[model samples]
Target chain A: MTDQALGKPEADRPAKGPLIYRQAVLTRITHWVWAIALFFMLLSGLQIWNAHPALYVGQQSGFEFDNAILRIGAENTPEGPRGFTTVFGQKFDTTGVLGMSELRGTTNFVGFPGWATIPSFRDLATGRVVHFFFAWILVGALGIWAISSLLNGHLWRDVILKPRDFRELPRDIWDHARLKFHHGRSYSPLQKFAYFGVFFVLFPLIILTGLAMSPTMDAGWPWLIDLFGGRQTARTIHFLVMVLLVLFFVIHIAMVLLAGPINELRSMITGYYRTSPGTDASLPLEGRERGRGRSGGRREIPTPDSSPQGGGEQAGANRQEKSK
Target chain B: MSGLILNRRRLIGLGAASAGSLVLAGCDQFDFLGQRNDPVRDFLERANSLTYAAQRALVGQQALAREFSESEIRQGQRPNGSTDPRQNVAEYRTLEANGFAGYKLRITGLVETPKEYSLAELQNMPSRTQITRHDCVEGWSCIAKWTGVPLGRLLDEAKVKPGAKFIVYHCYDVMGGGLSKPEPYYESSDLIDAYHPQTIAAYGLNGGALPVENGAPIRIRIERALGYKQPKYVHTIEVADGFSQYGLGQGGYWEDHGYDWYGGI
Candidate 1:
């Protein structure tokens, strides 16, 4: 709302949109909780991975088995002991990182350096303890979020991709590829797809594979081993899922920065968002030709359960309905 | 415009790298949470029992670990954690040298009848052969054939007392036991794992005698737990009401060193 923050000319100031509350209180709270919990889970997870620096694709793996798909270790060469990482039989020098790195004052050979782990030391016991505790926190938070989202119809309205959403997919993808973004009240097709994939696909896959690696779970759910092929294979999938989640996280943050960081941050933090100005609140149909209607301010994001007229959230919904 | 775009891309890449390194370095400052005596860790670690209880509910007591066929026994089990125990090497060698004729596994503590069995007696008793996966806490697994008497048979013969809640396995290995002290390596199991059909006192692996590298002569296997929970080079099994008298009173060697006592996960 400040002209200085916009850094635009007097002509552009006329297009500055009103700030409407687009995120709910629950959304803001859960978002921060997940941020903290994920930070702990990711680091502690790496700590556990450091214990066994190799990944195999079958039920059993050891000196006698040759099915390792990834292995990180240090080997002695004519030059000296050098750190190397092998993936699918091809090896790469990963010195000063991955296989070997300096910790504190001394360089030592380790799957991942001390700093990457929870304890900042090579202690599997501590790493597992840390990993499991935070794991519970994540599972619990996700459970609460899912139930709350379902009850409030947030799952259906925002996250679930409707048939119309598919029609916008190509356009959304093209806009994203070119660094263009649409500032709207509801989530765009891309955001819906990303959030849906994260919540419904990636998160469940990771948790399921993690449980499959447990001997007790395997005993109780005998079919779990068959589902993933084997315990070792489950572990491999668990590792792969972690990598994908990291990829998602990196892209997510990059998009936030590329899009409008302050506006985005304020929405998630205070439930307020600035829709790009076009249609006036009093004259919504004036900008209908632009296919983007604007409105005054609303205090909360629209839940499909709540349908009040004239509110910004309702205005966005009505505009979307007409477009469809 | 092209040059500016390239510069922006390079800037983003550098930003990501520095942010990553900063996070890695920050973990060192947060190591206090990992400190053994820290209250924060102790509070967080209380979740271990919750997980144990949850998994116990999910996996009932009688559920059996998946058994593999003889053909699935692909390799010799990986030897880990006290492959060569620090203590009782001479005594262990004497037992091995004489074909283990002199070896006697002692069953004592809260049992109604304390008993000692020679290697021959254990072999002669009822036996179970299982080709099961050996899962390590470090996250690798190996499959091999294990032939030995079920541990429950020996516990029944000894007659565990009503109050006895766990069985502590004292091994010949001294893990991190100081040079002057030489504390033996040990692990304990509750009755649920104790009576599981696949929980056996393995004396043979891959259809051959158990190799010294893999707890030769005898090692008890609790099939539903990780490798560390299965202590190797065992010489005694003590029935106990609680872990108060064991190494640091935490149930197992690794448990005392900050591992969760429940190994089901």
Candidate 2:
């Protein structure tokens, strides 16, 4: 929603009405690089966590203290050492997946199973190595992406939500809830919000919290530790961010499959997205899907000049000429 | 801007899918990543240097780690690594048997005077007691009080040689020797950290004599580093220009075993 959108420089964007070059080559490359880097970082991070397998809050944590908010470990049971995961003092038997797990028939005590970690064995040194390396790569990729996205106008026109997007938020939510995804020239209001949240909030939070956990960073920038409460709290927040990221990952994949897997994959892989027939490349996201049996129930997204009044079907036949 | 996170998410999703298929997917096949002569391993290891250089450049050597007040010492320092070197080394056993009265810390290598100080001599020297957090590399933090003479003070008395680049802390605990003889655990600190004010050769914990399991007679505490870098049961402090003569030439026992020598993180 800036001068870039007003200019509409993409003259040949609408190829046969549906196919369009949506994602840029740089975005595609960065996306795949990030994917690979994250694959290594998350697993190696799990391997690193296997070293301690416990998380706490506040400034201090040790044998004499019981302030841990989350702990994935095993304890001596009547039969043998059984695995359990505790969250906020509530324990759950997470045998086989967490804590006690079998590695070639010999069950070992680990935070995450071998299949979930880098090296697939206990090696904190190697884990840290892989984790840190990929971490730098991720940071570098993010830096490059930030610059390229800004230069390409994707940050402002595609990702950033405007006042109109906020007004249309309910429709986007309803569309997502009912699997009524609209393949548009630009992202839906929900897509913009989600992407913006990931780009600005989660990524930065995770990275900062990660750095705050480092003793060197703590020494250099004490305010970072203070920002996150403490090193332990920073660590806990880091873990939570990882969890949220994973949730986002699963949901994103599910959405891709539900909306149109082949089209979405092509868009990501080849930077060419096949937009819906109703999607007009000339117009921005304002009223692209004007009246194509859309807006099943209540229409919350008002057109550029007027409120959209419609129904489940045959409600916008009279407004077709008015929209044109 | 969303590409990396999406990229990561897709990669993780694919990894999870492969994991469901029971194929050694994602990170499982990354065994080649850490092997010697492997390009992947070499590349990964290089990142360690990058991290080290970046951290040093950013934090510098003079920045002080956060020091907690007396009230912040909520618990005793967690005993880790080779808690009691006496269990393995007979020399340490003898020192422990005699209340460490016969123990002597030998400071050798590239220094003006290769001096030896008894436990009492080290205790009587100018000391600093500060409450600090010990951040274990395994991702845990424990705060406790530690009292010992500043390592800079000891290095000053010995008059560090010009070419000395590192201070090696040789401990009594034997962590690994592979197929060779029993090699005692050791760690090294660069001169920048070596001369830091908070780097102490500690002998007291929680206002009491340091427990045997807590490195007993002496432990080297680099305040801004991880717990593993703080070598316990330290009996020798060697000033050296390089690590070519030490275990596998990496600088310390853990470093020899693939741990990064720089433990600031």
Candidate 3:
């Protein structure tokens, strides 16, 4: 087949059909699940990471007034009982009456709002419960995605870098530097590389670093700490990975805005997509279309130009696409 | 909008723009994780003992945790470790029923006088109160008012042996004796932490007699270490130079299960 034969034609495209089949129900569900997991992990982790309460620890430098106040309150309330004893002995005439005036004073109260305080979330027992549960969900879903993707051949087919991708990578880099993709097609090769880096490397790093910090998990899998350096080092890496996750999330949203928001959003939620038909049709079928074009295999991603097929096939295809 | 469709060209541009921020964030660790070992880790471990030596030169052992107002105290301050006293429950219950008239703390191991004192006798001695933050290894912390006698005074009264460098608290919550892993529930601290001004044999919390859940008659209030170090329902005191034979040789029950022995952080 000539290159032009496989290439999408300019004008013979269908007026409307499916744009692209980049996402499905499984992808949508997993993405949202991953997003929420990242959300709680960031917030709860920040609460513990709070070395300086005045400004975010992620920021440069700030006065640590809360630490000072806590120190003073700790000193006088429980340690400085001489004053309490003297007052109690002279005024109350009873040793039973305890003094605790310093603890209640407003000077000691730290200033985040009540909503930010989330009492249930602050409890150690509660925090542990939530962390463990969400951690399991995040791990379980990722495990399924990884295993199924490998079994379905999507891992090698879509994500893994092929010889052609490697050869084209430098041109992608130069093009990216020159901002040559200003009116580019779907995704520039460099953009694809960034997406692949996040999905394959950074996300896994966050998960592994988190597991390394868990004492029970570390005991069972001591090599995890060795892999990261030590417990403290693991904690530092886990925190930094979270910062990366946040950065990626921000960039991803910005990218969606820069691209066609409706098209991107629809592609993620529903499997069907309407593309500039003629030029792209033959390209999507290099492997799968060979002996199975009767079911309109590539054309089968969306609802037919005629009638709806089994919802089961559509659902199964959605899951298969996500595993990709 | 088709206009937002960056094609391949615009997408590459956006990707290059983001790479700079990623590089900056990645390179940040070099400052915090420098070359040599952190001196802060060692300094914190030696805080209790070194602070005492420094105090001797200037303040002469006067540093203490402050006492608090009665009204500001927590109504039912939650207990951290070993809340309900087991093993000696019947005996302790009998003592509590009789207002602890016969109950006495035995100070015997490696001591000159080998003294035994009733609760009333302990109350006769000088008392100290301190409101200090009880930092837990699991990342929660709370400030509580503790009233008790300074541990140094008690050790002085008992006349600790020359070889004793650490105070091992043998609690009433017994871990079965054997080479086979015994169920661990008690904890101990070094003599430096033992003699700390904040370290006390606490008899009261929030101005009242220590509640049963809060260790009732007495418990070690080692403020510097994690909450688990504060052993409740303390039965006997043993002073030892080494912990090689002590409870699986891990210092504490939880320490045997991978918790840090010096949980100073």
Candidate 4:
């Protein structure tokens, strides 16, 4: 090959990395399809969750109202300590109700009064409509993706970690911490762990929880409620899982920003990954150091300016220091 | 010309592909974030009438949700929401004590007949039994076999006036001694649902006395609606022109709160 073709660098021109193809068109499409489907599911799920909004540590039922006072006409006025009630010649404690009532007073539902809100309120009927319609769409897309990925060997090459992948995990973790790696290659173990968890655990949990909410389905599939520890619990878990999925999406977007934007963007968009020569398959060994690997800091950030051998210097230094 | 056209084609192809992917990516965002009614929302609002018309057109007014065998009945079916109804419990208990011999359900409002009948008289007229689920808005459910005369029969007997368009059930539960904004438990449904074959004025559960907590004497079971619309301890069934100008002017008591007026869930 000509010198210019092998690794081009000219005056006023940036050095070029090796051409690498990682994801196939199908993989890219399916990955993005899953992402979009998840977005709809999360937002609609949030609106439904807002109806029975959850509360944090000290909040009371996630609602607010004033403490109700009872005037018993002097014969049974609340006496003794704070938040105590007296009823018909006997005194009783009402500390719990008082605190809950006070909390309820301040943090009520947003917008107009409760009376005018019923017809206009966002009803479950609407939520259920969106939920079921999109649910079928998601299922159809997922089915097509699963079949396509299996027919291709993309599942094997991309998802299943190879023996070498396992062996290099610790080094990869160190490399990732120092931001020394590049894209257009396999994902690290931590990423695989999260991806697998989302696919196997979280997605399935949401699907099952959605099924458990149906009354007609419940008649035929009562066991779904038992499996999810009852209907309300399933609803709560569905909401919690949705929050986790949204958090995952936020973190994923942040990572895309931190990594070299153009390089990362090209890989996701075009199914072709352009990597620096050091991280490229042509010079793979140059990217990893021997004994100093775990201690030698490395990261997965892509090289800027399209340099082919960008990370070689730091990698070489780590190798020599470990060998000595 | 060929080379230039080929370059342009490739550019267009790539742009089309990118735009397609971007559209697909943003599709779900548009779906979730936007507040728009779906086909099912339309379907739910119209399902009662459609189901009614379909039954009339096809099954000749005899269609119903399938009934199950005796052994299929569940055990310990919870009372669901508003279980221990707070209004007129003493009145209900007094009837329950006497096995409801003195109990009568009065049918009035926008009806030509406006007749009140004893529980035995209502039970004797063309009964139907179906086991269906009570889906609560609070996210609990229970299956119970209900046997009663279709509300249509009672309404027909009462001869609902022409202008009458809805049936409002006055139930026996006042919430938090009127603290709950939607106090005085009650529910209502359109004429389409009020006449559905499955809709019944149920007086028995699991083939025994209607327990006090479970709306003794009678209750309206609008099966497709949520549990709160079931309207336990149904004292009177009134056909009205519209829910506005009724109690609190928002249909049923629960509907006055955040619950949907047509809770066909």
Candidate 5:
């Protein structure tokens, strides 16, 4: 089908090229689902963190031992209620946001601001409910995504770093540092690395460490605590991983906007992506042709109107065929 | 790089605009989205119940919380929440002065024999010593050696009634002293937790007589649960069908104020 027939916007229409189907239908759906799940999880996780704004090492830690690596607390000073965050003995005044914040005109002492929490109140019950609800969704989505990605060889063909990726790494980093994003069918080495690191390493580690911290999970899998050194250590690791994930999210969004948010968002939303006109030669033609071949039953263009019924299974099949 | 900077500025501008609009729309709207009776909360409740059930299924009722070695024990168990008993209560003051000699642990409600035991009687019972970690919901942990009579033995001796589903620990410590009213600190556990082998009415901590700060002359130790569940200054054990009669009807003091009743973690 012609680019004009697809009814893409003028900005999305390249001067001399067609729109490539970048993200599969499954990818788009799961991406949005994950986005929602992670949003709730992050907020609720922050709420849970407020209950005890400290992270420690080893099997056990308490007031007796000075083993707390991180602590967010508010103290009643002569001046006023002062909020402080201590990280490895270095204390910082984080009164307005971290340890204490003004919520609806009330100066409330909480680890994170009310705006950053799920319930936006000092309610551990509500926080836990929200957290566990999204946690299950996140875990289920991740499990399904992982299994399907493996079955389709997307894990190997797309995200996994190839030997060629190593050679392209420095150039990709240099280009990204300069904000010179190349429009192509395949992800940049940097993008691949970040996505791979988050999906494979960070996500799994966070989940495992989270389980390690669960008392019930300890009964079922005692080795989890031992593997992570201790429950407290697992909690520390979980907190660190959460921080890293937040960092990744910030950078990811920045990159998306830098490259062109509308185009990037549209690709993940509708599976159609517009690349620079003359960059078709640089596109991964073999993968594209393979996708087209496997997606033979449907030829409907993924315009805004027709995207929802675009058939995720067919798109998944096409991606799988491409991987093969 | 200039193009990048311009784009970044535009992104920031867009974000600021959206955020400003959201704030202008009123923060209460956000709260309304997460209102107590919202369908989201119902969904979350279902999820929590599912987790509770699944965890129960995965880990058998008898599975014990991990125990530690003596070397692993920290400097001492840290006293949390309300450490001291209410001084205004003359009985507590008199008991404290006499080293808890007058302290009597009463076992009532849903038992064949309503019994009361003094500190000496409790200490004379067959005891078990365990070096276990006390994980607080506040994210810190401590290891201490707890020596006490197994709660199962006590329950057997008292002969728990068939309908009894929970054991409520009535404590002497009263939080937030005021002329109007003071709240007694209390905790409860299901029968499974109550009868667990590690559940004990501890009279000794770290190989010494339990300190006043650590709930002398006794505290209940349910090793599988959080520190709050192992309430300090325990004065009475009431066997009940449920804990609805307790503070706020949520089973415990902390539980009343939004903490989970099933504090397995």
Candidate 6:
């Protein structure tokens, strides 16, 4: 039944012509779950950060050591109350958003504004609760996704960069900068790089650093703290990783919009991506090629066959046949 | 796809169970669900408890908080929260006037022998001096050398009763005053932390008598926990089986207002 539904020829479905199985059912489901989990994690994390708006290096930081790398707070100036963010001894006035913000005419001294936090208030307990809850979810989802993707070859075929990707990096960046995205089944080099960085490096670092900051975790794995150069340094790295993730989100959204949000959203939601008719001919058997070349960059591009039908089935067949 | 769905369902179920357990445990005042009573908050409260339990289990009863070297001792430890007791408190003022000569630390509750020790007596006792870092929940840390009697020694001397599960510190500072009823700042710790080698009733800081602003005559240092767990200006140490009747029954003043009682991190 699954095969019949997904394996139908493109000729029989002209209305949604030249559809590519860009996202598998598992991929689509995991994608949405990740979206929800990350949303909660980000907001709640901000809420937790508000409790102590300073980031530092080394194991210990306080009035004694000049180890503070970043600090957000409000101070009384000669003019008036001002919110400031200090990084490496340089202070920047960030009033009304960070360090200090006003809600209903009452000024509040906080790290991030209430609007950006999970509970939208200065409740440290609640903030921690929310942050930790989503943290579990995020970790679980990532673990499952990683295992499944590894087994299915999705990690290497789609996310991990190949030698060819390095060669295509310049072109992919230029194309993306110009908003000239190629509507293909395989990820662009830039997309592969971004996703790979987030999935492999940033997320893992965040999780490990987070654990390092926990006192209990320190007891369980003292090496974790030592690896990060201390709990405070781990915290600083965690905050930086969060900043990188936020940047990834912005770029991801922008790319989705530029490349066509309706198509991108539909692909992720329904597992069917409507490929550009012009690019379809040039990028024929792209999915099948990915399936065959598990090591990536080793397959030759086949000429476009007249029949667009059974591309999805052909890709699956190629995966099985190659393995055999 | 079905497996993914199952995973999500399992996650949601786990979240729900966590929330449900907190509600069932009847720690409503401490749980987010009892305060705001929302599904999200409920889930978060459960998660916090899971963290608390998991960390406790992993670290075990004897794990020590990281200690630093004397070179790591930064400037004098910064004073935060309520540093000074209210001037109107007569006994506190008198104690301050006589250089804490009249000050006495009383140990009562769940003990075979209740004992009161003066500053001089506490000082004369075998002392452990270590340079340790104080990590505040607000995201800052300070290192200072502290000299005091180990709490375990004091507890042994006082002969803690077997049923005692928690050590509650009654402090002299009164906070949240002005328009409302003033409440004394108090905190408590489990026996595991109370008995830790680093846990001390410190009377000296940075080679000098502890400054009044830095908990003055005495403060409790449970090195592994956050700064708030180290209650300053301690007037009495009470060993109790439970803290159900203390400060809205959540264990500490901050705990009553939503902070976790087991603030090990």
Error of 4 at B116 (Å): 11
Which portions of model 5 miss their true places by more than 4 Å? Answer: A1-17, A73-83, A93-111, A118-121, A151-153, A276-324, B1-43, B88-91, B175-183
Superposed Cα deviation of residue A250, candidate 1 (Å): 0.8
Clashing pairs in 1: none
Best of the candidates, lDDT: 2
TM-score of each candidate structure, all chains considered together: 0.87, 0.86, 0.43, 0.52, 0.82, 0.80
Best by TM-score: 1
Instruction: Give the Cα error of residue B168 in candidate 3, in Å.
Output: 19
For residues B108-150, write the lDDT of model 3, one tens digit per residue.
6778888777888888889988765454555434456888888
Supply the global lDDT for candidate 5.
Answer: 0.77
True contacts kept of each: 0.74, 0.71, 0.01, 0.03, 0.49, 0.43
Off by over 4 Å in 4: A1-17, A54-125, A161-167, A276-324, B1-118, B121-134, B138-201, B204-217, B220-265
Q: Note the DockQ of each predicted structure.
A: 0.43, 0.43, 0.03, 0.09, 0.34, 0.29
* Residue A231 displacement in candidate 3 (angstroms): 0.2
Docking class of 5: acceptable
lDDT for each residue of candidate 3 in A1-324, tens digit (9 for 90 to 100): 121243424125433222344443555567667765665445444434432122111111112212211111012345333222222124331111222222222222222211222121223322232344456567767777677545533344455555666788899878756644332213445565666777788878877876554433443455665788644455556656776878888978776665555556545545333343232322233234222435334443443332132223333333444455
Off by over 4 Å in 2: A1-16, A78-80, A283-324, B1-27, B34-38, B177-181
Task: Score each candidate by Cα lDDT.
Answer: 0.79, 0.80, 0.53, 0.57, 0.77, 0.76
Between the candidate structures 3 and 5, which one is better when assessed by DockQ? 5
Please give the distance, in angstroms, between residue B132's alpha carbon in candidate 4 and its true position after superposition. Answer: 9.3
Q: In model 4, what is the error at residue B199, expressed in angstroms?
A: 8.8
Docking class of 2: acceptable
Per-candidate iRMS values, in order, are 7.7, 8.4, 19.0, 11.6, 7.5, 8.0
DockQ of candidate 4? 0.09
Candidate 1: Cα lDDT at B205: 89
